[model samples]
Target: MLDVGSGTGALTRVLRAEAAGDVVAVDADPKLLDHVEGPTVVGDAFRLPFPEDTFDLVICQALLINLPEPVDALREFARVSRDGVAVIEPDNGSVTVDSTVGGESALAGQAREHYLAGVDTDVTLGSDAESILADAGLDSIEVTRYDHDRTISPPYDEADVESARRKASGDGLATDRETMLDGGLTADGYDSLRQRWRQMGRDVIEQMAERTYERTETVPFYVAVGQV
Candidate 1:
């Protein structure tokens, strides 16, 4: 099995432990390749550094959303794999957030709009990967959905601790300017958005201090499969 874009080898580690194969991790970042447990290669998704029909399975997780043309990457995967190709990607548009705070969900919705608008890639093509595979000229295509739930409530964890620190300094909110601009937001629009995000983060901090805020965020992901 070949794992492309194997950043930090997160999925590569899983495949190595669970699957019976010679798991190979490939990524453009040499720093990330250093952490991979098995064989590692430096490669790009658009043009994998392997001969045609080299591996029985080629896969990637959270890879397609960052790509400008996901099907093009999948075509390369198909070219390198002798038997199968798979992609695990998320549908950012399908995300749902339930919160006890009044405006947090609304604020999140606004931020999401800006993010999707500003980003160059199609970041929400999770369930649509099957169609993308079909377009890539692969046969026996299949897709499966996985809904992930990440909730924040009482007895917060380390991630919550980090969130609290960021809110105190408005760290995360301050970084939105460039992302919004890249996503096509005007300067005035980004200024408005940055203020709103900061206000929302402040409100979250206050609510958390009072031990009254609770949130449940669910993100939908899809596993697209195809035969080469």
Candidate 2:
């Protein structure tokens, strides 16, 4: 099995543990591939460095959503895999957030809408993987959905603390300033939104400090498998 875009070997480790045969980790970054325990290769997803029919199965996680030409990349995956190919991608458009703090969910949704509109790639491609696989000329395609739920509650961790701080500073929105602007958000609109976002972050911090903060986020991921 070949794991494409195996960044930091998180999925690679899981594959190695569960698979019957060997799992080869491949990525564009050599530094990330170095973290894998077994065989690793530095390869691009658009052009896998392997001959046709090289592996029984090829898989990728959270990859297709970031690519502008996902079908082209799937064709490449098909070229290398003799048997089947699987891709796990998230539907960012369908994500949902629930927070005890007032206005957090609305502000997050507003930001996400702008971000999705600004991004070049199809960030919501997970929901359309079936048709994409068909376009790649793969058959026997099957797709399954998985919801990743993230919750924050009483026992706050360091990561949670940092998240609050980032929100309070409006760092998260600032990071995507260019994208948001490109998505048609005016400078004044962005400034107003950021100001509200920062206030919401402060509210989150206060809630956390009082041990009354509660939030839940759900992101749906689709696992599409197709015969090559």
Global lDDT scores for all candidate models: 0.85, 0.94
- Per-residue lDDT of model 2, residues 137-203, tens digit only: 9999999999999999989999999999999999988999999999999999999999999999999
Give Cα distance to truth, residue 186, candidate 2, Å: 0.8
Model 1: per-residue lDDT, tens digit, 1-228?
999999999999889889997999999999988887758999999989899999999999998899888888999999999999999999998888888877778877877877777788888999788899999999998899989998888777789867756754657766765776777778887667667666766777788788887888899999988999
Q: Tell me how many clashing residue pairs each candidate has.
A: 1, 0
Q: Which ranges in model 1 have alpha carbons more than 4 Å from their true place? A: none
**Which residue pairs in model 1 clash with each other?**
118-183
User: What is every candidate's alpha-carbon RMSD to the true fold?
Assistant: 1.7, 0.8
Candidate 2 segments exceeding 4 Å error: none
| Reference-based lDDT, residue 20, model 1 | 95
CA error at residue 109 for candidate 2, angstroms: 0.4
